[model samples]
Target: MGATQKMTIFKLCILAGAALVGTMSVAAQAMTPAQTMLGDAPSVPKNIVIMIGDGMGPAYTSAYRYYKDNPDTQEIEQTVFDRLLVGTSSTYPARVSGYVTDSAAAATALATGVKSYNGAISVDINKQTIPTIMEKAKALGLATGVAVTSQINHATPAAFLSHNESRSNYDALAKSYLTTDTDVMLGGGKKYFPVSLIEKFQAKGYQYLSDFNQLDSIKQGKVIGLFANVQLPWAIDDNDKNKLSKMTAKALELLSQHDKGFVLLIEGSLIDWAGHNNDIVTAMGEMEEFANAIEVVEQYIRNNDNTLMLVTADHNTGGLSIGANGEYSWNTSIIRGVQASPDFIANDALIHDDWLARVSLNLGFEPNEDEASQLARARMQGKEVMTTSIKHLIDSRSNTGWTTGGHTGVDVQVFATGPAASLFAGYQDNTDIANKLISLLPKAKSKSQSNK
Candidate 1:
């Protein structure tokens, strides 16, 4: 049979299975799509959590370990990543798009189990809408949510919850969310959502919030939280370094209330921003915040054994390397001393005549005469140049290296646990991850609801 014929048959089966579920016992209702398609299978998870560390490759994880290690200990400590390491996944997009995948394409493959062009969001190469796992889960009466450090309409979150020909269509992406059945969305994009649009969402019974402190006020029902105009402040510079973890915890508290289950997408979106800037200090801070969010999900999974959690990256950025300038050792002590992102430090320097003193205080070290002279010269040049100089100084001190400001084609590690996680235990393509998660979705009910 043709592929189209096969899909029709599959849909028919889902409809029939939905009918059978009404007559079956509660135990039978717990059967997953995999079990329905295949006679016998493992127990399906009640909840699914997928975490994406945007632009995090193998190098980022390795760098984070040393950055987080305790020098006082005789043995190196294990991170949440080391404890949950399972396999790796290749991050290449459609044949038309090249080997190095952008966030949109990579997220599309992870959300829909299909490959598309680099800028496409949940759409096939032909620009047709492709069904995402979120849509499928919502159709099956399960709660769906997205929490990230970036805006809710950003590439990673948009791919899972909406379809767009271009990821840059922010207004359309925001409008699309009004139609989706998503239960929770928390991030930074107040600028994109106007009062008129917010009113519409309120009419649909969705609570809209822009204050970061107000996240805890709403205990139940649908909510949209936009904390900043664009992406949240860099973790290194932000007052609340644990923002992502708090968002994850809030999403869980609301999503877990549904009887059927939920599927949530949480992203460390600013990790990619740090990678793009080649700022080691900022990258490490983002990694720690992301790790904190993982800890929250890990605890939730432990308390609720029926939930499965998967953590991976969209692609590697900056081609980050541990050592540079012919140095054999990387100095994590220097990185750990830095207190703010280069951008933040540079802006502060621009406003003060005592630029050198400010830089020294933030870096936690006094630069040598020659280094200080270069930083002073860059400050005279402008804020952009000053920021670059600060990053270079940190790279020199820490022996860090980066090949590019853009993404690199590299395989990313996959970590998983809980029910049916073994399917992700070996090397596979990015689409395979989505397919496995899709198989875990509860079969759709026979309601006349539209998933668009």
Candidate 2:
């Protein structure tokens, strides 16, 4: 057969398999109207908290469960936050143009209920701006907030709160936040907003707070806090002592003060960063900290029963492949030992040759002495060393393989437990999430009365 014929046959097989799987999943789990209306349908949730762990794929979630459930670690307590299902999306603008989605397009689907181009935000294929669920919720008298470990103007959070043609237009997007009535916005990206934009926010009745100390004074109304200039430090970084969870906890505290309830989107943005840099230690630590934030949300929902908490990711990154069956034995001690050593260099940073040599020594590997000497000299001259090879070596030694240092097409998982969670019982298009959320809102009269 010719190459074109073979390609055609392969695509047919894939379509057949997908159809069979979809039919089986639907047959196995059918929802009744009462079950579907558990949270929002019957009555709008008093509060909704959607947590996005950017680039958190099935591998990451499985790893988290393994560590949490392991008898030796007991890292986290058992809870009802365990049930999960896979999430899906037609992220590409055309069905024939199926491709792995970047954070921008995937988040646009989740936020605006539309699949847009890879770089588009809440705008549709024709570049028409769409009202995001956040905007709609705010219009309905529900207070809104967005918190992320990355720049607040990054693709994921910005998709819900801003509508620029490009995600790279951080400066303009940062300024747009002034027009939003979002109650408690907190995250990184101080540089995106110049002194003028800061002044604009202050003029618009927003109390701009840059430090965690100022959060305590925020009793109600709108507030914006920019902690770091860019993406925040990794959870393992000594500089991140304050931690991302602290910001999330504070946002939840303040948003809950609204009488009509609120909608807050919290993102573990650095998990994607670590994945892009192939930094296993940083990725694992961030995931743990994200779970800590989830615990806080779970506690709030447990007490307030009217709140709905949904946890998911925009897409998978790094195509993280766990375990090396015959090449290496996978054991907890081995993994821990590899992570404990200082020799495992992350490619995300620029280090000197002397530092590389020290890392090589710690890992019991003999690195190129000439290269090490050159790096040391460069460091003396205030030059940076590219540590790509060192990062690859460390990842190989740890037995954690990654297909590429980029996003993958694999579907991610979504876990939910609370009012309206039944709506998330099966595989769903990313846009379906937005539709379900909108359908859950109370009637217009109730919302208007709540505002009064």
- Point to the candidate with the largest TM-score: 1
Clashes of each: 0, 0
Q: Give the per-residue lDDT of model 1 (tens digit) for 1-452.
A: 99999999999999999878756634533342222323333467889999999999999999999998999999889898887777899999999998999999999999999999999999999999999999999988999999999999999999999999999999999999999979999999998999999999999999998899999899999999999999999998988889999999999999999999999999999999999999999999999999999999988876787888899999999999999878799999999999999999999999998889999999999999999999999999999999999999999998999999999999999987677766686699999999999999987655455444
Clashing pairs in 2: none
User: lDDT tens digits, residues 197-250, model 2?
Assistant: 888888888899887567778776778888788877677653544466777778
Instruction: List candidate 2 segments past 4 Å from native.
Output: 1-44, 67-97, 239-242, 325-328, 331-386, 446-452
Measured by lDDT, the strongest candidate is: 1
TM-score of each: 0.89, 0.79
What CA RMSD would you report for each candidate? 9.3, 8.0
Q: Which residue pairs of candidate 1 clash?
A: none
Q: Kindly provide the TM-score of model 1 when superposed on the true structure, using C-alpha atoms.
A: 0.89
Deviation of model 2 at 439, angstroms: 1.3
